[model samples]
Target: MSFLTFGVGPSKLSAETAQDLRNAADLQIAEISHRSQAFAEISRRALGGLRTFLRIPDSYHILYTSSASEAMELTIQSTVELASFHFAQGKWSQYFADIAKHFRRRVLIDTVEWGQKNDFRNTFVPTEADLITICHSETSTGVACDLADIRAVRHRFPSTFLAVDGTSIMGAVAVDIALADIWLFSVQKCFGLPAGLGVMIVHERVFERAADLIARGVHNPGVFNLPAMFTMVQKDCNTVATPNVLGIYLLAQQMERWNAQCTMESRERETREKAELLGRAIEKSSSFRFLVRAPEDRSPTVCCVRSDPQTITSLHALCRAQGIELGKGYGKLKEETVRIANFPAITCGDIQRLLQVLEHVRSRTPAA
Candidate 1:
């Protein structure tokens, strides 16, 4: 039997956690009264705890949904009044742009070559539009954008509300909620919980815009309605219709536990250390090269790598045989790249094990 490889999230839960979840299941509340005071308290505290962990300022508002993708859709469909500027190079980021097009929104898309740097600052202006979207960490290529750089660009557009998809980096990486109008992600990714819940931090100004759109009847009123969500969230009630109560309970417990041990600084350091450790191995391995064009822009969580196609194939086989599953390259970049996730749950030993397998695989193959 091989050790489980950590590619994305949902690798494993803490030992004590599994027990707690089983216990909660035994005492599971048969009737989930959404209006119950108990549920309201849970929702209230969960939002407070989540916002505290994210270091959201008083100017921001927090909300919950079924999934992070839902949060993204809500933010996009509700208040995207003018035009949207999308800076994307990865498969997932490209998908967000497609989502905007499906809604018939005016979209300006700027794409850099895979692994290349982009200057969104030069292309954006306050006069151009008020709705701008960006991805904080691109999992597809394991590249991260500088948040400070992005924030600086946003400073030029005081009226612009920035929407960020922070799926792979929110809890694991430090984020300033003030820099964004809408920052969203799922519990499955960085929160290290089950995938059903999406946590969103929205600025009050953005909420106002959403409300205005709702009043004007310009925004869709169904699943993507932010105004309706805001009402439920403000009252600490459920607008989610039917929530995954067990999953959310697990999330709440995990978030509280994570809050006690995981600070943004410390977790970011851990992420950096793991990335550096694996990067050293990659640098020393003559058969491998990082897929990201620049070292500074590479992500601490997702590590994208490249090698000769045959060698990459052999390495993949070796890794899978050894019980270390790797992520395949995405979209136009698939043939030349592979991705490894160094999420918080993945230990240093895990990285070492994968490196050992990689080295062994390289040794058996003839060097190009």
Candidate 2:
């Protein structure tokens, strides 16, 4: 049997975006120096548009990185001092802890069950720690933490910086950058752009602190070089090696489109509606169920599903035959779950088509 399967991320690019990519390719010329006016202008525009799209505060400065993981590494490596507290439950959250430990930063980890909610008020966070990191949405398990609740916890520790990985939720959801000291993400997820660009909106205070650390020669600034990043912004150029020119261009254009049609408030409402629609469909499907149970805590962009891996694998094969590629569950949850992304670009018709395909797959697959 053949049908389109719903899975997380790298969703089918919109035809308009595809055309924009083709246009970009046509415009590419050899030896367009990164320092030249052409590239700097592009970088400047992309940064401005991204900040506007994300509703990032004017006090927060924007910086570019190669990927979200790189942005995470930079933020963690640079600002994190002493033992930091990490909220761990999902795959990427676990990695956040692991990365911090690799940086030789002491980790105070709080782990909840895969599909369970974490009350930051209950978590034993250290007051002495300088940084606390959490994934805004854990794509692997489809658990999205309440940013407002988490920020309330941060308020208890006035000195600690809050860094959130908005990788899976950014544009599709509403995140108050003011609540968190660092909000970082990549273009591939909600921005509906191809991979290769990562953005970080950092608080002015964090930048000031980083600058002070650099002056003291006490902090080792690895990938998160605040000084260098600030310099590039002044130059109207993106730092951290050569920027992804084409990705930046496409992202800027996409942001422009998003502004023209959908604002954050509208995007958030649309995402909630789509996720509800899809979640209800999955709940009704006897062959499949949600990995994350609650809509309130679920990621609007990535829906992790609970099912037999073989069943999911078969369904994936069936979908591919129909020109639809579903995302596989990552890491420990691979066998039991699959992910479905429902962001802005994915239309209501897309969800309807996916549901139709899933129903067909269910009817054909024998009951286990």
Candidate 3:
């Protein structure tokens, strides 16, 4: 059975993107040499489109990686010589902390309850921390750390390198790049592309930090640190290894259209509307409610719903029957929560159609 869902990601692609994919295959674009000008053009347009779409400043350069997790590792290993601080609100944020731990860097974390937003007003980051890792959107719990709160952290610790993980909301949300030194996310999640490709938007200061780490004889981050990657990217818009050329091609094509027909502002607005539509439907349902109760804390691109195991089972079965296969909950919340993606690829009518199915299976009893 074939299912058509655009939620979360490897989200379903639109007809236009599907055509682009087909065109790539027919033209044998993947067989081209990575060192050739053909691939450089692809990387150039993709990076340029990303800059325009995300409103990144001239001071920052976007580099390619295999995934956001790799970006996390590279970021920490590259910049954090002494210690790194994290705002841990969910699994993914904590995972970033764990990555820093792997490098033997001292990790200081300010944590909030699961599925809740980190309160930055009274938060304290140690002055000793050289890097700050903040997950702009937590995919695990559908929690979004608002950009304003991010600005608070930036204002408080201007000297520390602020790295943000915008995995679930990058393309769907409008992010002012000046808020962080490093902003990275997967192309799969919000950019409506196939998985295995990531983009790391990094400020020149991050590379400076890496250079400082090296000059001090403290520790060399390794072969493909941010500065190294930046150097290779400068030679040609290419990675040290053979990259996801197809994904890059598709992204370049998609970004061109996005920049033309739909700006980040319009997409962000639509994402909020779709997320609100899903949240309201969940609120109206008897069987489920948002895992994140506070409206502002909820994500504009990922919707997490909590319900009993039995109801969850029924919902899945029902959704699957309609070829709208819903994803199971994440990690420890596996039996309790349902995660739905509200990406740009998925239209408003599609969500409403899913809501109709949701309405039918909802429990008659009021949610507690």
Compute each candidate's TM-score over C-alphas.
0.92, 0.92, 0.97
Candidate order by decreasing TM-score? 3, 2, 1
* lDDT over C-alpha atoms for residue 254 of model 3: 92
Candidate lDDT values, in order: 0.75, 0.77, 0.87
At residue 282, candidate 3 shows an lDDT of: 83
Task: Point to the candidate with the largest lDDT.
Answer: 3
Clash pairs for candidate 1: none
What is the lDDT, from 0 to 100, of the residue 43 in candidate 1?
A: 64
In candidate 2, list every pair of residues with a backbone clash: 7-339, 8-339
Per-residue lDDT of 114-230 in model 2, one digit per residue for the tens?
A: 987677777778776778888888888889877677677768776788888888888887777788888888877777778778888888888777777667775777554877787
Error of 3 at 320 (Å): 0.5
Go through the candidates in order and give the clash count of each. 0, 2, 1
Candidates ranked by lDDT: 3, 2, 1
Error (Å) of candidate 1 at residue 262 is: 2.9
